[model samples]
Target chain A: MGITSGRGRLRTVSATAAVLALSGTGLVAYGLSKQDTATPPSPGRSTAAAESPSGAASSPPPARKGAAYAVPQGDVLDRSQPTRVRIPSLKVDTDVIDLGLQPNRRMEVPQNGKQAGWFTGSPTPGQLGPSIVAAHVTWQSKRGVFFELGAMKPGQRIEVDRQDGTTAAFQVDQVGQYPKASFPTEKVYGTVDRAELRLITCGGVYDGDSGHHLDNIVVFAHLVPSTAPHAHHTG
Target chain B: MRTTTKLALAAPAACAMIFAGASGAHADDGTYTMKLTDTMGNNSGSHSTATVHVMGDQLKVHITGSGFTPNSPHAQHFHGSFSENKNFTCPTSAADTNGDGQVSTEEGLPMYGDIMISLTTKGDTSPKSGLAVDRMPVADAQGNLSYDRTITLPAGAGAKLKNLHIVQHGLDANGNDKYDLDALGESTFAKSLGVSGIPQEATNPATCGTVSGASVGAEPTGGVDTGDGTTQGVEDVGILGLGALTLAGAGGAWAYRRRLGRQS
Candidate 1:
């Protein structure tokens, strides 16, 4: 009877220890996650310019005498096709495919919704005009690259890796939700003198009958001018 | 919800009409597009997209623009050389011949030539109405303008439509949001139009683009099907895992306390 009692106590202690170990591990994981959320990994180059105090002053001055009201010729990049996109806040990293017009002249969408599609008709990312990058919020039984796109706030960062071996970083200027019926085509696709970007995905209530969302979430952003000498070029 | 659904249903049909009207190709029908950009070196944050659809002699001109002086009439026109052999282009900052810091209308004439067709809201659509500010389209309160009109082209004007420059004139040079002679002095082309005391802001070219084939293309209308609704209403997996962990920890603590009680 005494031996059995001792063994039972030992078993209980062992179980408690095991539980404590698991709880400790959970706390450690929680800590790591908190750290991740607080400080996203700062990628090299672009982040350096963004963090610098003189970043704004370093940009080229507005055109000559009419400087007061003139739109600052912000850094415009040469035309280059974007190959990849990364939204650090959403932890979205995906390959970008070229999307052309369909036979009916509508913009083509990504086939599986896992990858992002850059509209080939618009200017490439970091060009003078608005560059469009679109991805799905969710695929069949899976979350797409831009699933949390609607949750993104202004001032977040979106990085696009271009075919020219350069990464163009963009700072979110606004996040807008519009009904699919009035999608503000001109605002989304309008011409801007500076390098701008538009990240789009489906949002709002999902309709089971139509099998689509009722609204679109668009993230408007502008290229963060690099500190490199080439950033001074203006058209 | 019902109204929203009805709007959704009607939107696609309206979009189809716009796309067809903008790009439909037929015999004697051609669509030309222009991407308007700032004429002066100073980026005015003003831009526009002009689409001209020519069906025989009927010309349908549609223009959408923003970043203009609000609530002010912007005189827009198709400017090109009358000579069939000569083609004109948009002027650059060098066109500011008088060094007034703004590109005046007469200074840009060498590049954009004379006004071929005045885009007016009513009445005449001729060069005679070029400076007729009251006849031009006034931008809305937000400094955005949308102009759509169908005009009967004069004989042989359809052929001259290609390669012409589309110029949107009028700006707030002094940032006062009104056309006045305070900032850049009197207008250079005001005398030519027989209108005196016109400010340079009233006649200065704001935006310019060269009319070309429909190769400019149109943006896709409406929303995209970007989701299949698989993950809707589901919490983030990471958060769910964390919640499960927390619950288990609490459960373990309670069990641990009960065991201590029994041991005591």
Candidate 2:
């Protein structure tokens, strides 16, 4: 309860501010397909801050650490498809390929199934924006890149050691299940003006015929400024 | 003023109110949205600040600056409990309860609020924070549910968005949508979204921001953070509707009290 305000007097208080604690203004994310879970688009209005289940009015995060990273304010880079991703938390380190729109903007599962494919729709990791990294939990072949992503807990450490020297470290903060149609892509992959990441894998109950997992496993983390982040990643 | 300033300087513990409001805006869920500011005091020169947006049911997010790596992705969320509330604002002081000089969040001693949000890169940094379905928030804590107390920066050009300073908004972004950020509350967007009146609770509350006993958020139910100008660091912002909730609870409490009287 780091709350400092309520019915209307400014009491001025403070609580733990995690993002500012990390000292970076950007994050990473990838895209996955799902139906919208928000109260329909409502025509002219975009989404409001997530309302309290109780319907209280509030806004988003505002804690800032007086730290600055030299992020290049320039052109959008063309992202190459990520062939694979490695999540040490789940004992997964595998290759990934690209998924295209012909297949309706999804990743192609590896034939032998050693790995899952990356959606071309989102940004590639270390590439400047949010990137979608997904893997199959199980296949006729095997477990995929993000296979164990769902099992992670808070305070658990994760490192995406990119092929390049720049490796991003993320501390797990949240995990949950969502129906295929309930995925908030714009909320998740639309645009945030920062670098971010998203790891996806099929989970929940598996529907054999539909081939869709009852839910999707999403792991969220931020790129810690590697004292020596990859040369290409930093400006 | 300098002595009070000296007393309030650097001692984050003394300014727990400030931090809670900060974390509440950036982390807390439901009725909580904290914001942070730099250089405490009314004398204003701007720095950086941010406003958290816990969109959908997932994360607390804030995407400022130029476009996110242009056609790229970024991982983001409030790195703690992320819930939404119907209304709220920031609190700026501590209410002495139980005669204790210190303010806290414990049940009997101190009860404050907080907000928070964080970001990470992928494959070396990102966590799914936007526009993706297969990938949603991984943990409850990782969800972004808070905001940075908005501030203004001196060098406000290169990355105006990154500076977490809360602006004395003239144009209503009305919940963070730049598309309608300047549509003036006269359009269909304003009428449809219902952004007409300033949040009533924000303007008036049933409680006086103080409590005789250990109240919620330092003051009693329905307090606010003057941290917007008086303090620095983080601040809690929860429209607990507690003041409202308490109203609903009064009938229940009285009935229970009467029942106890008869039982005795």
Candidate 3:
């Protein structure tokens, strides 16, 4: 019985090797044929569907040089307006309002402490470039929506629900505090290579003379891939 | 070599002719308003409006804004081409060099011509005078400044507001007591100004506007508030109420957190 089992195992190994060799040849031919096709390879067109279902199982597609971030794997959320923001770590959720330039040409702050204002002039939360959402740290002595923003740590998750059903998840990267006198307007409001978020609120010492805070607390974050694979990132 | 000298001499003659025409046109009286619009990408919420009443060489400038930083000084200038036929306009987003998103006063110069008058607190209003950015005044505690003053402009002062553009600077970016060319650039300038890694509230363009026509003594439309700084008492009460509510919310949150801790 042991002799018979050994012979059967050897036969099975041989069969497996032959099958693997054939598959390899077929793969090579498939690749050659793709190159021989009249149409050039479209880098923007993802080959995720043609590859293995598991992204880790397949060899990576050629990197698009000069591209800033990873190409999303599935459907990307459209440029819909954001309506609300929720940070799980802070246990805070608040409505959002559209903000425009004040007569002084400054960003108009949200009058209500419970809500935040998203600068409409900037990109939407999920679109490319930095999207800004500003709120008051304190209104009249009450805490504003972003009052606890400074306490948040890196890797905490934030979700902004948009006018569309889609919600863009964001992971916190860093938190910083700057005096109002030296606010980094360019860094906070400037263009970035990828979709970004900036949560701002007044911080530091309160100046009674100006009736404003001396510093502004900022939280920087980037979009987290949704469970549903998108065109840009792996799920 | 002779032709080059002749061209140089012709340049002076042409300049003299233009100056003569400007002087001749200075006597025409007209009322114009500078609706100080904010530049693209800066959202400081400042609204400044100035009415320039011209009567020959004497120019009466009535300046007002919603508010400025209580004690922060701002430098402003009347820039652009001052010509009878030339109509200068405010710069578009194309002026944002280096793509930092906010255009500085220097960056907008290509679109608007050179500075025409240095809107100084007190000094020379000559086109070549560089003191506009140096001698500006600080805004009051209420972010208000209402100064009704008559200043003398150079000959052909009537051409001054022909296509005037008002650019306001937030504060001395480098705090060097004067505006330096390098001080106008961001990042590097902010560092030199000792404001690196902080909000650039001190060095931003406060507000900007183009010259528009408005009647004399008329309240300029938009955001120029001429209120007599007496509205703080009622606002203080409202703020106190909000503060009380915030305290109550904090108390509830603390109790809830304590409960969660006990349970955990």
Could you tell me every candidate's TM-score relative to the true structure?
0.44, 0.32, 0.35
- C-alpha root-mean-square deviation, each candidate: 22.4, 28.7, 26.5
Model 1 Cα lDDT, one tens digit per residue, B1-264: 111122133222111111112223222344556777775543455788887776667889999999988999999998985556585766655566665556678888888888989999999998888988999999888999899999998876765675578889988878888888997778768876677898878888888886432421346756665655555343122222222222123333343344346546
Give a tens-digit lDDT track for model 2, residues B96-165.
Answer: 1221211112211112222132233222112122212123222122212222222121232212112122
Q: After superposition, how far is residue B207 of candidate 3 from its true place, in Å?
A: 39
Model 2 chain B worst lDDT run, 10 consecutive residues: B206-215
lDDT of 1 by residue, A128-208 (tens): 557888877766556777877877767778889999998988888887766676677878876455678999877654444
Task: Give the candidates in order of lDDT, highest first.
Answer: 1, 3, 2
Model 1: runs farther than 4 Å from truth? A1-72, A103-106, A227-235, B1-216, B235-264
Docking class for model 2 is incorrect
Q: Please list, in the order the candidates appear, how each scores on TM-score for chain B only.
A: 0.69, 0.18, 0.57
Candidate 2 or 1, higher TM-score: 1
Interface RMSD of 2: 26.1
lDDT of 3 by residue, B4-74 (tens): 11112212111001110111212244455565655432444456767777776778887888556556666
Worst 10 residues of 3 chain A by lDDT: A63-72
DockQ of 1: 0.10
* DockQ (0 to 1) for model 3: 0.02
- Number of the candidate with higher DockQ, 1 or 2: 1
Question: Which portions of model 3 show Cα errors greater than 4 Å?
Answer: A1-76, A228-235, B1-264
